[model samples]
Target: MKAEYENPFRPPYEFLASGGMVASGLAILALLEENPLPMEIRIGAAAALFLTALVRGRQGWKVFQKKRRLTRGKRFLKEETEIELDDVREIARKNPKKLWIGKGFEWSSTHRQLMKEVQDNMDETKLVGPLPKGEQSKYRETKGAVWVHGLEEEKNEKDIFIPLPDLFGHLLIVGTTRAGKSVFLSLAIAQAIERGECVIVIDPKGDPDLRAAVERACIAAGRADQFVWFHPAFPEKSARLDPLCTFNRVTELASRIASLIPSSRSGGDSFVAFSQRALNAVVNGLLQVGTKPSLIEIRRALESPAMLEELTWKALDAYCVSALESYPSLRDGAYQANAKSKGGKRSKCDIVIGLYRQHVQPSKPNTDLEGLISQKEHPHEHFGKMIAVLLPILDMLTSGPLAQLLSPEYFTDVEREMINIGQIIAQNKVLYLGLDCLSDAMVGSCIGAMFLSDLATMSGQRYNYGTIDDPVNLYIDEGAEVGKHIPFIQLLNKSGGAKFRITIAVQTIADFAAALGNKDMATQVLGNENSWIALRLRDGETQKYLADNLPETTVQYVMNTQGSSSKAGSTEFDANLGERLMQEPAELYPSAMFGKMPTCEFVGNICGQVVKGRIPFIKREEIKQAA
Candidate 1:
């Protein structure tokens, strides 16, 4: 007997079968006209047709489900096991591969539970914390500040978050050039300003990116009046004579160089002790002569044969006195004393000092020295509230004595004095010093390392009295170039307890890794970062780094397929004609394919929730026009 005929109308197949039924209905209509069928028979036939169609439709649906299962089963299963951000208790980027691509994340069960807990408890007020007590009587603030947006995409983007409550510590950001580092920094600055926090930016290059952002943020936060600019104008002479003024200009240079010398180079403590004694002797000798001499004058006096022959107490005294006489304040020992006094009090201006050797150098040595003294005497006049020192790394390295004096061990007393001055300036106010023009890889690293070490020491000494509740964020652009400084890396990666947050930016992983000195350390720094804003990084190594460091399952989802496919098949059956031979097996498959898309993931409470997006790069003109 022939196999029981199955209902042909089924989903996918149903559409085809329905067309055949319509033709059959037309045939029935024709037959009815020729020989009208009984109403009962017609009803029975109609009912049977309906039942067959229903069965066919059900079967088609089953087939469709089976086809979908072939492709979606694994994905659906994986998604079931995937964890959400809110559920994450602990998050870390795991690197199974040496390269950054194909990195994945390992999460604990606690992560999910904690995230759920956080979500359940989330309240706008709680997230932002209560406004300062006094502000309550002012007005009922209902809305939360939204500074950034649009980071929910699956692709990496350049965006970062710095939460206020979690910001009472230090931070270090490291990335290669073109790595969307600057954009990340901008986010932090914007966030701090929105929260009514004070920020001082020092842009030595005079690029004004940070400065402009700070200004904008201030305006947005209704604190525009608080923004201050402190750029000192150097006389033409100083700009020309930049090399010679090194001896008479800034005192902090010496101190920084001295500090860097591995004590061994300078004969350890003994060398420092000797240097101090020599400086004292020089000072005493000048005092005895009743005349003040400038550094140049003193050097000239020392060169005389008569002074050198005897090297007597009387001769030394005369030389010292002559040098002291040039500066009236020093003649009476008041200059040093006054400096000490000024260093003690809090500075009134929000200072942003710009130190650029090329700009300060003068044509004439005498004129330059005079300008230096004048600037020093009236720092407030030139640098109002903020001082942004734009030091020219190239000029300082190539033309000035600073190149030699930068050596820690060989630093002259004058150089040491400059460093001390820098320390004093850092101590007295809320300061952000940006070292610009640090193009040299080695110098960039050295300066980065030295600045942090010195800053930490000074801050530590006055920690109690000068604890800046307002966190200070350090924005280091081109971090990979400056990554040569191991100390800088160490400080940034580890110095979180202090109210210093380091934000470094670079273009690529290779640059960053090279600057870090060791692959392990580079990994540590990148891994420790609480938040990562991945921009378009097409390099295989970078991609691999992300793959190895981000969640594997998440990466797979990001890499799913999208778009269509087709297939054909044939089936054979035996028919009654000539022992029944029939063959018909045709199939067509059309489906969409999906692969990975760019994705970004935020990991730690330290960074909190991140907001990532492209912000309009507003120039000063644009801002003014908007105003």
Candidate 2:
């Protein structure tokens, strides 16, 4: 029978103390026996020593048994085995239980020297360069490597390194403010850049250190020109990041835009749906009219209620015409005079054919639907409400620097060429959007969410149509600012296979819940993420969230019992042992320990592997060297 226990019957400290007492008592009894003491006293002293020695010996035996079990259960020695960043497998659990893997570096006198030497090597580089000789030599070619942050050592000290491919499925990074999460994110981004992977990092705060690291990495890769930095406030100095650059379809793009509306934060209500429908009409209408409408133009077009109503009928007319053209037979009457003859005048088919010929078969798009809507021929009562829904959203975007961000004319800095998001990703280019939250968070967040949604939609289409073997990562820091973007949340489950990796960093679960507006829904989204790295959390909810993800074990206990029974004047002693099975709750990790986890330490569950590790320290000089 196997038993898992928090506190054993004979703990190490108690066993040691009892053993010491027994040893001293036995020695005194031996001395007393040799000193020719009285028979009664000697016998009594011997009886007490014998009883004491027996009790202590029993406890010591139990302690020795526990030690033996622990020794036998160990698969590898922490001191003998060491796991480097590259040594970590993409799937740790797939490796056999007997696999030789160790937690991170064992801290000792030698490791102290190792850390110091690593620091010295980092500082020695005057410019962006390779790792230290010793460190570089240990590296191996694999999927991709992040730094060796920490080890998982509870069951056995095993090295846990997050691989790039594993995160193609998506990663959720939860940490409070100043919890070293941003540092770890920087470390991960630096590693990806060093690996020559194209990465897009969205920083709401516009952190200088992170920007420097990205710049240094670009220099190291000799692709400095490939790096594009976009700051909304200073649009002239940065790359032009227009969300429309990734627009592929009218309906999808409208949905993405609708999700960015702050009013939709309470969940996609009637207004959100109406806004999406209205935006959809204008976008399709502009394309049909051969106008490459930017957000400014789209917003201007939607301001006219008549234009939106007209566009709606035009879209519906176009759809009906196409359906009839593809299946002309379906348009024929159900009861025809002859099998080969056209439908009768009594049939509705003739009417549809006439309308298609009049409005849809022209060489140019027939967008003259003002008469139809004004006369109340097609648009129902919902038309006016839908148009009203899109006005406020358009107002927010067409106001200030945010307007410039989506304007085609304002994006003329690239020699009148807009940045092609799909091409940038397919060709592998680093694009950084530095939207400083110090001024206003809404602009950065709304734009960032739109950009992410568009990219995910494009990537998913690419996966379905073309082959995408290379992975692309989206790093969004201060994710709370973006809030509940339904499109972005949907990407969590779909993008992994499309080679779209997203790492969302937020201050707390509460923030995420507030953004999502439903705590249960937010938790479901978090659970869908294949990997989670929690740094430190103060609230009990967040702590329990981490603890719930930890590993669970089945424990069996053997209860030993001894009892004395008295019958008449005689006494009989009996002992019985029974075995029972007990289940450990979903909460596997100790919640208390995680709440008390010091800064720079993180507990993560990645690809079915549980890990608790510390973020490796990078000195100020080292940061400068990397930069």
Candidate 3:
């Protein structure tokens, strides 16, 4: 491929040629003055010089115009750049396989110079021009348009794209609220949908525009049936999803629910351990009784002694029936034990317990059943107190529409079709899961956490045994709201090989720290993402984080010095002119520029290439007919 044209940021050769032509013309005139010549010959020579000077000057003027046009900063004054579906189709048609990043040119040395020029010329006070009496300060951020909205156009300014394989490395998008994070996400999600990739969006604090964009993309792709909406707020329209339905082991079910209960700082809280153990026993008991474990069932078993007793008895009877068939002689002993246990006040659990000890425990040694019996025999009040931290989490997850949504009845008929992470991945469906965090934060957080757990579990299964299939694009917006769970980090760490491309958007680095409860862990999570896109950021630490990640460039500047001294009526003057280069020890993209970025503009390090780009707001419309 031919090298792309790049401006050297200096005067072109045409200026030098113009200067030489004028110099030659002047030298000829000087020689004619020194040596006599015919008037006609001198006039002819003068005419030729005049014509040559005019031609050179015209060529120089053209070059100057071209240079000014190339170097001039272009600003997008409109807050949004709207693009129709037809434009998207055209771009897709041209680049059949490229993953569209956004619309802009590659970040080059020329752009760097342009950015520096904008910064050097920046006058913050002048930016609030012609503002009303007291509103100047309110529009201070508008000053950023000098650099944020400023873009330089080159020949053939086209859609910017990164390689499709780069997406598997995952992407992290950081921006403050209303900083075009949603617009970027919408464009990305729509493209993924158009690619027919399995797309999963986990949105905590849902945005309707994001959801509509995905839907329209599906419609445009002729794959509307592949779209599945799962929102806690709209149960009637939302698809039912059972987060607990895809666990391989019963203990996994326990761990999924237990993980939501926040652990103490020491990581050795006795109550937390007890709650996990309790969950394990309950899950085991339910599985043994041929009943699938669900949040409501676990909560009920923990809250009610009668439910635990019933499950324990059912498991014991099932074990006894199987054992009795294998060992016929134990049947008479079991009957005799039950006969001895019969009384008005005596419970059937006591008889089952006696039978298990006499017939099943000695021969088979069902430790799982023993744990269940122990939990049932434990005092209900004490057990509830032990799992007090666990109940509210379960209650939040299984309450109201969530009860049916999270714990869908698999065996029985239900109005909404049940979907699992595994099936969604297998079928390559588009799933939009809205947690509605604004309405009920605790419940929404739990639901989002559980969904991440489910996705993590699915990723593991695919990693261990399943084939590497089409890429799964998972977008988690406001990731800090639900990323408290360990599975989120696990998903980031291990999901790459499983062909899972995870894109996470967060408001700031501190949000991750606050969410994960550790600054280092937040760093670890952010580290997993190979690509970083930064929009408008107002937080100090987040700015520092982004600045640290970006590689530095040598910024060039000119130095001018002059000195004059007069002593004892003798005057001396000296002047010096030199060009100097300095290394910016800090950010390649200035830290302060982060806060001033326009809504739809972004600076990103995508696939090892730093890019300054603008993402247009995608609209559902056809190509307009030309008049």
Candidate 4:
């Protein structure tokens, strides 16, 4: 391959050629001056030599330089040049004519010296623009503001702030276990509180420092009364969360609970469907007859076949009783049906009919207390299996403090109703649910899933029904620990308009896949969110997922070939620039670098832009002092 010559430095031959041309012209002029030749001859000769030397010298100089440069590779090239700039300070009023330039400094530098020329020609006030506005300054952060983590471009050390409304209302935060996820969480929580959006932090790990930071933000925003530590672990210090009581729609409640009940390969999909169906049946039964709806009641219904049959009959009976009273003609229809069934003997079914007619109230029946009794004919063969499948799940929900969490009335805190999550949204308050996952992992996860589902319901309803006006942010820490119970598909896709800004932090994609039961579904959940911040991911899937979000760019590659020896004299080395796209994760930032990013630094793929940034470091001491 032939060597290619680009821009090159001047060599001795190029300078000598340029000098020779001038020397020859000068020599011709000198000879003409010393000669006694005819004027025309001397002038013509000098002019011809001058023209030839001028043209040939210019061409020869370029050839010599290009040849020299081709022989030597670019080993010593200055990439940039820096120079000093001086500022002149003049006392305009006192002495206009006698101005003194200030001492020189190295702040200014330019590729072309145009800025230096401008500095000398124009009057300037200060070197840098007024120091970036303080992030915490009252003028910068206002009610309903969202603080974007890093700068729009890599220019300075300043926190960027955009209004909360500017975002699409969702975020996915992915990072390894100890990759400063908590730090970013703390920062977001702090700023979110300052922004005055109703903040609800569902932390499975029960972080105390996070609680303190939230308190500081509440204090900073002068909404301390709005700050509530919603610690279900210590129900005595917090409000009761009756999963059954807060909702108006019981079917939705059942669906939420069903969503939390994780499915397993042991049962297959049929078992999952059976549990959900039976749970829906049990919840509907409990809600219909008003038998103090709670997880304990559901547990009782699941444990006893007799109780389950009775509840089912009772719920159906209440509806029958109501229909009969509302239209007394139903009594005649019931009598006709009873007569048709009484041909054989006074069976349990007949006994049920007899009791209903005998105890029927004319104008009024206690809808809450009275219901039909289960007969021998009832209790379908599938009912027992459904109950069996649902028992352990109900047990999980009813175990430990979780059982106490879902009731509006509590043993310790009686005077004030444990404000439910819906109220938390409507009233615009900050709630921190510090689930003690470290101590009771299963119970904590179950409760977290339940609360997040309820919150997602409220968010979805916010737009469809126009109930909640204030923006709500759901900051879920250790989201993967919640398992497959969280209604991720619903939250990721539909919770935004209701102003439920979801920001979920997980350690890895594997954890999410574990929760989702499939990698594709896990990715779908992540895909719904508009913004993502991934820091130091060890899992290849997580790294690949994030790297995939980056746009493809054309990159130049060098192709080196050696020894093209057709003959002994034909041995050669060649280099060429080839361009192709960078496609794979390995071709991008190494997984190792991302797997071990420094604290506060993260690879942020947000709002259609990708950047590797740092979350301004905040110390625990600072939060403590501020608090």
TM-score of each: 0.41, 0.62, 0.84, 0.63
| Better model by TM-score: candidate 1 vs candidate 4 | 4
- Candidate 4 residues 233-255, lDDT tens each? 67667756665554556567666
Question: Residue-wise lDDT of candidate 3 within 410-430, one digit each (tens)?
Answer: 336667788888889889899
Clashing pairs in 2: 103-157, 103-158
lDDT of each candidate versus the true structure: 0.37, 0.59, 0.76, 0.58
Candidate 1 C-alpha lDDT tens digits along 118-138: 333333223435445765544
Give the lDDT of residue 344 in candidate 1: 60
Q: lDDT tens string, model 2, 516-570?
A: 7778768767766787777767777778767767655332333445455556765
For candidate 2, what is the TM-score?
Answer: 0.62
| Candidate 2 residue spans exceeding 4 A from truth | 1-159, 262-268, 304-389, 409-417, 553-587, 619-627
lDDT of 2 at 400: 69
Clashing pairs in 4: 240-418, 241-406, 242-406, 242-407
Error of 1 at 234 (Å): 8.7
Q: List candidate 3 stretches off by more than 4 Å.
A: 1-80, 89-97, 121-143, 146-151, 326-345, 410-413, 565-586, 622-627
**Candidates in descending TM-score order:** 3, 4, 2, 1
